[model samples]
Target chain A: MKTPTIRDVAQRAKVSLKTVSRVINNEPSVRANTRERVQRAIETLGYLPDLSARSLRSATSYALGVVYDNPNAYYVISVQNGVLSACREQGFGLQIHPCDSSSPRLAEELRDLVRRSRLAGLVVAPPMSERMELVRYLAANKIPFVRILSAAEDPADGYPCVYVDDRDAAYEITEHLIQLGHQRIGFLWGGVSHRSSPERFKGYESALKDYGIPLDKKLVIPGDYSFDDGFRGARRLFALRDRPTAIFGSNDEIAAGVLAAAKSCGIDVPYELSIAGFEDSPFSKQSWPALTTAKQNTEEIARHAALRLIAELRPPGDAIAAAYAKNEGFSPQLVIRDSTARARLPAAD
Target chain B: MKTPTIRDVAQRAKVSLKTVSRVINNEPSVRANTRERVQRAIETLGYLPDLSARSLRSATSYALGVVYDNPNAYYVISVQNGVLSACREQGFGLQIHPCDSSSPRLAEELRDLVRRSRLAGLVVAPPMSERMELVRYLAANKIPFVRILSAAEDPADGYPCVYVDDRDAAYEITEHLIQLGHQRIGFLWGGVSHRSSPERFKGYESALKDYGIPLDKKLVIPGDYSFDDGFRGARRLFALRDRPTAIFGSNDEIAAGVLAAAKSCGIDVPYELSIAGFEDSPFSKQSWPALTTAKQNTEEIARHAALRLIAELRPPGDAIAAAYAKNEGFSPQLVIRDSTARARLPAAD
Candidate 1:
């Protein structure tokens, strides 16, 4: 028989992890009927609330450390808001720390933060998620953690995670351009170390291959994730004798940067050149024509991940098992805006 | 003789309130030398190291509740960071609750947060700084607090505070603009009811007066501290038949927003218009031409505030008094960047 966790209980309860936490804390104002149903589910599932470690005595908390790098203001703000909401529901406080994802100091910082707080668990946001040392540190420390994917991890077992399906999203976006009758598409690659960069590239390639389009290696450009980098990357693409008809920048900042570069070079958006970006942020709306981008639901991801960590702090109840069995992966929703259109590919008949 | 509090001892010992707590409880790890110093300080100041109401504690810690409602990312981030840093150093936990600055729920939410966590203190940010009900409620309830200014207050018997000199900073900035040959300068205003808005406007007015320039009510525009407001404020100023030669925005977001609007209108920057902003934020650099603004040193302010709050938790000593007197007020540093230039009036001789 598969052992149950509190997360399973949350899933079965049809409530957020925070909601379950409130119930466990015996906090008031919960709808009486709903509480009764949750209680019934709990009794039926045979869930046992676990408190094996001194952590219970120290503090009965569902605390999780959220660490991030790649300081896109919108991304950080969204993630913070999501984590805050989840923490509120769980009766937990998130310990936020910003670290250089690639720095050797990362492991040290995580260790200090965890040891100092005696954390219940963790949630790692890229580019820290892709670093092996981070993964190894979390594993070695025996801390349950979920990593937001910059790339897809195999089998997703080390610690259960909620991830953005970047690959599919990227592929669909690229396909949208192709379907719009664009032949040559320019790719803006984020920093190579981020696993999502390659995954997104793969998605683009797969879509092209599926459509019987020959890949042009020259059109793929690499740059760090920033407005300046985006601007520069687009500039390189534009300077080419055979410029791509449309561009796919890594993220919104890069897309904006690309837009600025194009405008300065006498190119109009969506008319002379179409562009698309990832991670629909405030920047997307603020952009000149508004950006057509993928909405990653960073807040939802943070909330769910926090919910998972908090829920797992409880002992396995049968209801939790039932709940866990219901929801496994959450698919992202696409948001359409004005930044993209059918590419005006010269090759179009 | 004046009675002392544990904050006094902590300040004198150059340790945390938690450390003072440990010393009072005779918990381990305090050096013999430091312990003796604390003892001597306690004796000299006749301070009580213990709060009998709180000292008889249970398993849970005394949490600090923070209520805020400003969207200036840097400001929000800094405030949280400061509170977190203090909480960590004090060995106490903080629960953050976001409340509307203008909502009646502000007091209710704060009271609820306090009741739920059994909070020991609060750090109120702007918007709430001027809320009389909030101040009265906390006073009536005997909740200790520190208010980051939205307005100046009567200093006598006021709670220990950490505040920004908005009027002074604003005055200095406007004076700088004046020195660089600007008249008919624009003054962007912040939201109504925030005491700082009028205070900042006063500084701009005073600076113009000092230079013998007439206060043109036409140049003062009202908006919130938002990017969109910045854009609109600039538009309102530019739409005038005789637009100001230089613009001083309320905050960095507004400044950046206005900067963006200027670019959209195809106005030659610095050549045709001079722009200056307050709050030297990351957004300033992110702007196209960068921004010359005031560096309020959020980190230092937060660090000092946290340290001050902790300092107030221990028994007082002569050394502690010396330390407190040394750190009364911090001046905001004027961070001049790429955003401002000497103004050339519309019809210059």
Candidate 2:
């Protein structure tokens, strides 16, 4: 006839109050035997945890926010799926917040989101993750968070992050083209604001240098990551006196544009020119001749980011929490399809 | 510092307590002048509304759940964006819940979700929306919800819904192919469980009947809504002794598959054959030569569903709520692209 409190459950289980709280919260620190005992006591007493009250007491909610500013539907959904998987596993709720990275009021908006929702932590996605100003604001507010970033190495900013090595992936893609005897390899840049653009560019430059190929300014076109940009960039390359034997679009959308441009110009793929794209998006596989791209596991990266953020919300000194706190990295691998082949030899005198 | 209550704000603004609550929830029925007065009073008093306590008293939270079981990344993201837009405008929160419709415990899972999260209502997307058993469960539990479904007419089930006329769209697509001097047209079916498939098939059947063409069972292939289905279906049609001049895929992904199949078999599209697809998705545009398909405004439909769900959660007798309660429908328009053309005249006829 009486409502059972957490204290009652703790007493019945012969465990400390903190252990009951940990069991109720489903934290990994509670031993299996202790967890089972607490569960039995809770069932016997018909005790139900007051989730909101628990959150208020702990100064953190059982929810994680995934903040993203991506236009690509495929990329955004993949991130959502990844974060959702981690949340389901850890018994945490997910709140997906899409924001305008270029907005001046971004920090204020994010702050209000955290305060209003009482979120435990956040999983930040680029290009917001790459913005130091926003990251600094989060740190200053003492908001527990993890970022999914594009970098060759850890920034060592005393922040937990899951980073992707775009530079390394780009380098491998370039090396593949070079090995195929492509001397004039053109590159199309993604949005300048994105850290991926510069990281990928560095990889391209490194590969060119290693292969003893001189870089041509004309071959490098500056444009945002889009199908239209790829189309325009490829057209500019094709109009040159000596067109490049192959072209690399920073992302798949740009590469798709190049493929369309080639068709418009009556150029045969692989036989006349090879094309490579980053990010093995759906279109890359659906594209005619299919595309040769680097398979970047965005879902996996996002899942790791969410896991780390949730771990940070757990009690310190937990082995699982410590493992998740360590910095994580990923490098996309090459996927060869119908888009690339050996370059054609020139006619002799 | 003494915290101000809703009562104090309402008294200061010279408005009813209900009016102040309406303004706080951002309900559209609140008069502009009244809302402004309430807003000023709150700002002057530095009053912060207690969201959690308000939910407990009202028996509903200021959050709506988007329940979907779709594999299409593009479709899912569009739905989320639409729901988010409505939530932002109405000062509500959104929770994206992707459920396994086939799971035996789906009903229990959904019930737990609503109870634990205390959602105000739900915006359901197909094929979950088409499941009568699930719909009955929600209605039985007195849950305020709206469904986005494919139907030619309102089911008038007392519950509100946003429907798309897939049959009409399918009819127009088939008629376009027939008008292009094509006597033989093939059809690919989407998932049988989805209501859209049957609605589309009905349209295709009706067009053939009205055009004085006899139904050929062999020309109608059974498959799910996928690229592989389109590819396999197209191949079967191609292997026929008297192949059809055009093929209608249930959706864009299937149409893309048909295009690829044509390339694999060395068939010249539009000249030797034509292809049509439903749901003019991104791949339809990205495909070689593009695709002639129906443009379904998924975002608009989803936004309308969310609006209806939110309206149902509002207090009864509100004018805005009454307006949103009316059933709405949409017909996808035919978009002509490069994939369809007139059937080539028989040589030496």
Model 1 TM: 0.74
lDDT of each: 0.72, 0.88
Worst 10 residues of 2 chain B by lDDT: B50-59
- Model 2, A260-311: lDDT tens digits are 8998788989789999999999888877778999999999988989988987
Go through the candidates in order and give each one's DockQ. 0.10, 0.35
lDDT of 2 by residue, B1-349 (tens): 3446789999999998889988987888987888999999989986666544555466558788899998888889889999999998987888899989888787766766766666788899999899999998888877778999999989788878999999999999999999998888999999998999999999999999999999899999999998899899999999999899999999998898898899779888878889999888887776667899999999989998999888787778886588797889999999999999989987712
All models, RMSD in angstroms = 10.8, 4.5
Across residues A158-196, which tens digit of lDDT does each residue of candidate 1 receive? 655666667888888888888888888999988787777
lDDT string for model 1 (B169-192, tens) is 888899988888888789889887
**Candidate 1 residue-wise lDDT at A9:** 73
Error of 2 at B25 (Å): 6.3
